[model samples]
Target: MLHLRAVCPAERTEAALDVLRRHAGATHLVLLRGAAVEPPGDLVEADVAREATDEILAALCELGIDRDGGVTLEVIDTSLSDHADRAEEAAPGDGSDAIVWEELISRTGEESKPSWTFQAFLTIACLLAAVGIATDSPVTIVGAMVVGPEFGPLAAIAVGLVARRWDLVKRAAVALGIGFPVAMAVTAVFALAGAFTGLFDRAAVFGDQHQVDFIYDLSAYSLIVAMLAGAAGVLSLTSAKSAALVGVFISVTTVPAAGYAALASVLGEWDRAGKSLLQLLINLIGIVAAAALVLLIRRRGATDGVTTRPLSSG
Candidate 1:
């Protein structure tokens, strides 16, 4: 279930209330007259099933409640009311299968920006992966993968393309195009410093580091794993099975490959660096393609009543 709260203008209150009252999955509706001080209107609240959230949001949007007034939705972890259960059951589809577009947009929108925090995490993950590569430590590599924050922008790109949100696509593209290069450059500088301090192992870069060779050895397997991971990642986001996202994190080698490329370049292993970059590109391409396909399928299969509009619609 989801908790929905909307402030509606005095003139539009009835329309918004009707939207909630007519929906089987929108229950426990409350309307407080002149309750909104800021917008100076009525306050409307309801418990909406996950399956019906998209429809309700779309309806409210069409009435311009989200613009003149305001609308907010939050997850309801538990609902003791039998009314809640009935609401969920009455909904056309299972909650887990629902795609709440507003939620997804809010979640990925900020991630599309190449914030300092995103750059920091990516650089840190790459540096950690570089250490793991030098020591041939699978455990450290896994940790680095979990720490990497590259998936957000990748997901944003997928969602943007499917939802026809070109601004999102542009922002995500800038994040990836700028963030990766910046991370790799920082990682390379750090690797150079480590080599000067005799902390980085040149032998690992030049010799047979078979344990970490998979990071650079791009193959059909890399593409397959990346696609699977990408699908699972988007599924996790849509279904609210966020824990599954961790598995997706460790399954792709984008960060590790970047780290490997950075260290190899600093070590003058140009061939190894080239191969690592190829591996990164392969994983990125596969992930974006798979994720876009999944979102496209979900959008196509959406219920007729459920429609998605950009947060800022034209």
Candidate 2:
């Protein structure tokens, strides 16, 4: 369920009330006239089923409430009232499966930005992966994968393509294009310094490190794993079940591959670097393809009025 609050202009209050009254998914409606100070409007509040949020928000936007006033949505973690349960039952679809496009888009937009924090995380993850490759440590590689922030922009790219938001697509592309190469370059320098100081063994990077070799080893399984992880990552984002995202992070080899490529380049292993780059490309393509497909299918389902169940029972 979601708690929706809208500051409606005096002239549009009736229209907003009608929308809530006519929707079966809305309950616990409250209206306070002349309650908004900033916008100098009436305050309207309602508890709405999650599945119906898209339609409600659209109607409010159509009424120009977003421009003239404000609309805020907050998840209702626990609703102890029977009215809330009845509202959910009255709604057309499952709350968990609901694709609240407004929420999703807003979230991805902020996350995909090329912020300093994003760069720091990406660079640190790459550095960790470089060390992991040099020492042939699977644990360090997994840690780097979990810390990598590359998935945000990647997911944003998929969402943008499905939503046909070229602006978002361009922003995400710039973030990834600049982020990956910068991270790789920084890690390369770090690896070179470590090797010179005798702290990192350049030979171990090319040795039979069975545990970490998969970072540069491209195969059918790499594609399969990336595809699955991409789908899971999208599902986690849409459903607000973020714990599943950690699993997605550890399952793909994107960060590891980038780290290995940097290490290989610093060690003058051009062939190994090429292979690692290929692995990186393979994972990126597979993940983007899978995530875009998932978003497109969900958007189509919503358009066709197909109700979807949540991935897990709350």
Candidate 3:
């Protein structure tokens, strides 16, 4: 369930309220007229079943209430009321299967932005993977996987492409575009330092690599696993099953590939470096393509089920 609040101008309050009132999935409606301060409007709040969120939000967006004022939504973590159950039952489809597009847009939009935190996490993850590569440790490689932050921008690109939100698309693209190379460069410096200090084995990279050669050795599994992980990642985000994301993170080889590639470059293993980069590209492409396709399918299915045009940009 979601608690949705819409601030509507006085002139548009009735229309907004009427939309909410007519929806069977929207209950606990409350309206405070002239309650908005900055934009000066009426405050209307409702408990919306997750299954009905896309429909309700699309209707509100059509009214330009989002443009004139705004819409805010938060998950109802504990709705103990019977009315909530009835609301969910009254809505089409199950909440778990429903797509709350606005929330997704908001989430991806924010996460897609490049930040110092994003850089630090990516750099650290790459560095960690480099260390794991240096020592031939699968456990450390897995740890690096869990620490990677590349998925945010990857999912952001999917949502941005699906929504045709160029601002979001560009932002996510820039994040990924700049993020990987910078991370690899940093990992290379770390590898160089390790070499100088006799802490890293430049030739261990050519050894067995603890059977982790899959990070650079491309095959069908590389694309297949990446695609599966990508789909799962997007589903985790859209359905609010975020706990599943860690598994998705561990399934892809992106960060490890970057780390290995960086180390390979420092050791002058041009062939290995190139192959690692190709592996990384495969993962990125597989993820973005699968993620975008899933979003497109779900969003389209929602629109068709409602017999409505695409949700408005507002």
Best by TM-score: 1
Badly placed stretches (over 4 Å) of model 3 are 304-314
Q: Candidate 2: which stretches are off by over 4 Å?
A: 303-314
Q: List the residue pairs that clash in candidate 3.
A: none
Against the true structure, candidate 3 reaches a TM-score of: 0.94
Compared with the true structure, the alpha-carbon lDDT of candidate 1 equals 0.89
Query: What 10-residue stretch in candidate 2 is worst by lDDT?
Result: 305-314
Per-residue lDDT for 176-263 in model 1, tens only?
8998899999999999999999888688555777688899887899999999999999999999999999999999999999999999
Per-candidate TM equals 0.96, 0.94, 0.94
lDDT of 2 by residue, 1-314 (tens): 99999999999999999999999899999999999999889999999999989888888888999889999999988899898889899988788898988787777767888878998999999999988887778999999999999888889888877877666777778888989999999998898898898877756657667778888877899999999999999999999999999999999999999988998988888888999999999899888899999988877767332122111111
How do all the candidates rank in terms of TM-score, highest first? 1, 2, 3
Clash pairs (backbone) in predicted model 1: none
- In model 1, the runs with Cα more than 4 Å from the true position are 304-314
- Lowest summed lDDT across 10 adjacent residues in model 1 is found at 305-314
- lDDT tens string, model 3, 1-314? 89999999999999999998999999999999999997889999999999888888888888988788998999889999998889999998888988887778778877877888888899999999988877778899999999999999899888878877767778888888888889999998888898898887666666655666777898999999999999999999988899999999999999999998999999888898999999999999999999999988888668433222233433
